[model samples]
Target: MIDSHAHLYYEKFDEDRDQVVLRAREAGVVRVINIGTDVATSEKSLELAKRYMGFYATVGLHPTTKVVDLLRDIALLETLAKANPDRVVGVGEIGLDYYWKDVAPAAQKESLAAQLDLARRLGLPVVYHCRDALEDLFAFLQQERIQPPGVFHCFSGGPSDAERALALGYHVSFAGNVTYPGAVNLQAALQVVPVEKLLLETDCPFLAPQPVRGKRNEPAHVGHTRDFIAKSKGIDPGELERITEATTVSLFGLS
Candidate 1:
């Protein structure tokens, strides 16, 4: 299985990062995409991608990060992607997040637009993170004409949101939160996501699945999410794994 999104470079895994990767391999997670939230973390992700065989990296600035000079940061992301075309798989973990009003909505929109433009210029896919700003995100995408060969990571939206994302040519990735007993909206969204556009992720060191909730998540725990999604969809777990794995590989251009 491919853990389509993870933050394996976070300090949470500092003590035993290698062991965590080993565990993921043992758990049948053949590939992991280490996502970036800012310049520093993006560089760290690149390093980890270089160090690990089945690991890939993405570069982007999270909406919540203070952007004193958005142009400079976007340029830095471009430089990184150009420098490591093989290792940098996409442009992502980038999108609107109104969950925390710390950053101005205008700035978040600006950063998202600039980054999307960068991805288009580079001929790379994207990994989006939308939280409490689905309406605004959809509006922006509609206005900008950004046809995504990308994904909506950790999707918690309703069926309409899933439909719109699918219409935009983006994959919908579910994470551990989908396993929560109370996640009715996610379940509804999952039902609308066709098998061809489905992807599974851990978003590790963050949203750990049930049976391991409240614990620091790792790539290995992706199996729990895969199993839950398969059960929710009433499909065989092995078949679900095969379909999602193929979708992930095709979306991210993984080897």
Candidate 2:
């Protein structure tokens, strides 16, 4: 399995980060994409990617972050990403989020616009993060300012969102949240998305599967989500793994 989105650089794993990677390997999650939300963490992701085999990194400014100088910030992110072509695979975990309402909507859009333009200019795919702003998220996506073949990571939408994402030539990745008992809408959207267009992620340090709920998530717990998705779709677990793995690798160009 490939954990398509993870923040192994997070302080939560500071003590046991190496062990977490080993646990992921033991659980058969061979390839991981360490996502970036800010300039510092993005550099850390590149450093960690170099330190670990089968690990890749992404560079982007997440919506939650304060949007200072959009152009300068995005330019720095682009420089960091371009400096490590061998390590950087995508531009993301960047998108709109209205959940907190603290970060001004205009600021989020400004950052998102700059980053989306950066992704297009860099010729890299994007990994999106949306929260309580799918409506505006879809609006930005439809504008075609960003490149194609990005992913809506940790998708929190219904069947209509999945369909629209597919229409836009983007993928929808489900994290451990799909295993929640109350994720009826997510489950239904899962059914709507063809396995070929699907990707799986742990989004670790968050969204631990039901079996390990209320715990700090690690890449190892991704299997629980995978197994749950397989069972929910009534397909062979191995087959699901193969398909998701292929789709993830092809999308991210991960080795």
Candidate 3:
């Protein structure tokens, strides 16, 4: 299995980051993509990817933070990607985050557009981090003609949103949130997401799935999310795992 998305570089695992990777390997997680939310984290992600054989990284400046100099950060990301093409698989966790409201909506849109353009120019897939701004995100994608291959990480929209995303040739990734009892909308979206476009993620150390909810998440716990999604789609867990692993590998060009 592949974790598709995680932040193992986060400080949450500072004390035993190696142990976390070991646990993920023991748990049958073959690969993990440590996402970058800023320039510092992007560097850390690449370091971890180099340290671990099956680990990979994505470089981007998340829109949730105040990007003091968007152009500089974008240049930094480009430099990182160019320097480590093998380890840096994509450009992301970049998108609008209306839930935080710390950054202005206009700024978020601008950053997202620039990053999307960067991903296209880099010839890499994207890992989108959208929250409470799907409409505007879709609008920006349409207006900018940004149709790069990517995944809508931790998707929280309805079936229509999933349909639109699939129509746009973007895979929809679900995280631990999909296991929540109240995630009816996500469940509905999952039902419509064809197995070919389904991707599983942990989004750790953030949304831990049931049986371990409320705890710091890790790549090893991706199985719980996979099981939940399999049951929701009425398929065998192993089959779901196989399909998602293939989708992740193909999408990210994992070796």
How would you encode candidate 1's per-residue C-alpha lDDT over 1-255 as one tens digit per residue? 999899999888999999999999999998999999999989999999999999999999988988888999999999999999888999988999999998999999999989999999988899999999998998898887656589999997999999999887788999998888989998899999998899889999989999799999999999999889888889999999999999888887887
**Candidate 2 lDDT for residue 43:** 90
Residue 12's lDDT within candidate 3 is: 86
After superposing candidate 1 on the true structure, give the runs of residues whose Cα lies further than 4 Å from its correct spot. Answer: none
Show the lowest summed lDDT stretch of 10 residues, model 3: 139-148
Model 2 Cα lDDT, one tens digit per residue, 81-111:
7888888999997998899876898888888
TM-scores for every predicted model: 0.98, 0.97, 0.98
Error of 3 at 22 (Å): 1.0
Candidate 1 has a TM-score of 0.98
Candidate 2 contains a number of clashing pairs equal to: 0
Sorted on lDDT, best first, the list reads: 3, 1, 2
Candidate 2 residue 172 Cα shift, in angstroms, is: 0.6
Ranked candidates (TM-score, high to low) = 1, 3, 2
- Model 1 RMSD vs true structure: 0.9
Relative to the true structure, how large is the alpha-carbon lDDT of every model?
0.91, 0.89, 0.91
The positional error of residue 203 in candidate 3, measured at the CA in angstroms, is: 0.2
